[model samples]
Target: MKLKSGLMGTIAALVMGLGAAQAEGVKVGMITTLSGGGAGLGVDTRDGFLLALKQAGDAGSTVDLVIEDDQQKPDIAVQIADKMIQSDKVDMLTGIVWSNLAMAVVPSATAQGKFYLSTNAAPSQLAGAGCNARYFSVSYQNDNLHEAAGAYAKGAGIGKVFIMAPNYPAGQDSLAGFKRFYDGALAGEVYTQLGQTDYAAEIAQIRASGAEAVFFFLPGGMGIAFMKQYAASGVGIPLIGPAFSLSQDILPAVGDSALGIKNTSSWSPDLHNAANKAFVAGFQAEYGRLPSLYAAQAYDTANLLLSAMAKSDVADADAFRAALAAADFASVRGKFRFGPNQHPVQDIYVREVVKVDGVLTNAIVGTAMTDRADAYADQCKM
Candidate 1:
């Protein structure tokens, strides 16, 4: 079921009665997974985006936000994108959580002359030959953290490793990203069904593979289920993956099972910086929880849009695009810049899950890669 934001309803009513001058400022439509198994990721993305706008106060009021739940279905996301572009006439689109949904929506949205400021879901296809001037990812490419995980694995001296991910575009990128850095024997490689909860078979395979470590990229509820089952199954192999698989959003559910698991991320709540400190405090004050990587990216995406709006009118496509490309906003990730493909060029850090004051959270343990640019950036002609 597609759910519309109540704030969007109020904004739509206000827009209907206003003349062009009265209905000023940018109209943004957000299509994201807000239901089913992947709700946590989408919820965090939505909350983070809104939290940034909320902090903007008067500046935030310049944006008329419209939100819709994609329900984790590609077809549903496409339908929403079409409505937002053709009917709603939004100036831009943002806030898609899953890569599959992003694949369904981004290209068509940008082709129709609407900018897509991605909050998450930066697939390699969009970052490479499929790049568009109007498409900008506020988050890292899908392979970035996975690549860092691979580097960590290589540096940690794990001779043999078993890897797994969901069978999807992001999953393909995940394993390929790991292989790009890890020059080690793969005891086993598996691609489980996307959104699959049961891991009995996969765990059995990991046990028999003689692997010294296991790396898997399962996000949202999938990760929670897998981690719980893996811990219960008595598999002592170290678990590793990108932050999405072990971020703040899932840590509470995964509980002690996630302790000591090393994950790679571009941002963490414990990150030392002025912008990050405010973001973490504000997120907890607003939502009563620590912000996840998804939240940090979404918060940055909102600020990026706001900053561009301040410099150029969205109606002026060229000027507005240039404003966005400048990336003048302070990112919660600290040092953030767009690569040639409009994907992020930033540091990826290794984090170990730990309890601080009995709350499950990740602590930065080491730097995995610095000033890392995705391998596919050179392939992007734009």
Candidate 2:
């Protein structure tokens, strides 16, 4: 009889514990492009979140990360989000890289009262009035990075710039961002369809336009194609862009052609910080290749989550959210803080492609930009 009563007590305690967690643990849904060309960004994000989880360890977090791939499709993203919110019952959702995808996914998540932390992708709509307390951007606004590129181009005194990007929201935003800081004459601003493989028409137009420099924002496979075409065209003009195009993945593909090209970025493998040094060493040891900004950002996002979890009861979602808002995480980026809008206010750097030990890669040129504030910070009334 005593043994039976003891077993019954244990069962009761277990049920109560679960009930308490149901009332509190901040379950999260993570959505990203886990397959196809943009997979690198997702891989990096996953790794970062994992790193944070490991570091946070078993605090009070019965925290569950429900991972799903959008497959770079809007329909898949929405479907996955619905399953997470309704069936899986997640309290928060994060991670979407493409602006088009984020634009579609964010509204529903916010409307349903789930906090969304954007690991990447900054659509202008979120910044200008669509802002929400349920939403926070751990990355910059869509235009911030491109704006840095524009500022650098202006400072370099480039006479005329031929801007080319896909006719997507991000592409449009990038051109506007560049134009904001660049006071030079526009040779021509051409918009191509998303995933247009052949750049012959655009390249020919660029050459004929007689622009002194070219600015582009093509992440993943698109970037690889365009840069290769630019090199083949004998475009002598300086190739300057944001890291999205000329990143770690595209660097190997672009190879020698990208040598001397410049791109602005938040992180580079060559960064000298202890955390950065350790990360590059470990990533190289694991993947046998250098980590890109996508990888670094994902890594930081995970670390941020882990840090916040450690500071508060993961089961207590509200407390964890409060801790995250007061972000005191040790990011590989050294010190980064979340702005009112949940976007990070961090320094930006300019890196140039240089062959290091016979491998063509981006080398940190200099710090062209520094700790800059995003335009939408004040709007995040949180």
Tens-place lDDT per residue, model 1, 243-272, is 989989899998888899899999988999
Residue-level lDDT for 341 in candidate 2: 71
Q: Point out where model 2 deviates above 4 Å.
A: 1-26, 51-63, 314-318, 378-382
- Model 2 TM-score (2 dp): 0.89
Candidate 1 lowest-lDDT run of ten: 15-24
Count backbone clashes in candidate 1: 0
Please report, as a residue range, the 10-residue window in candidate 2 with the lowest summed lDDT: 18-27
* Candidate 1 lDDT score at position 245: 91
lDDT of 2 by residue, 273-313 (tens): 88787777767776677777777776676666666665775
Which candidate has the highest lDDT of all?
1
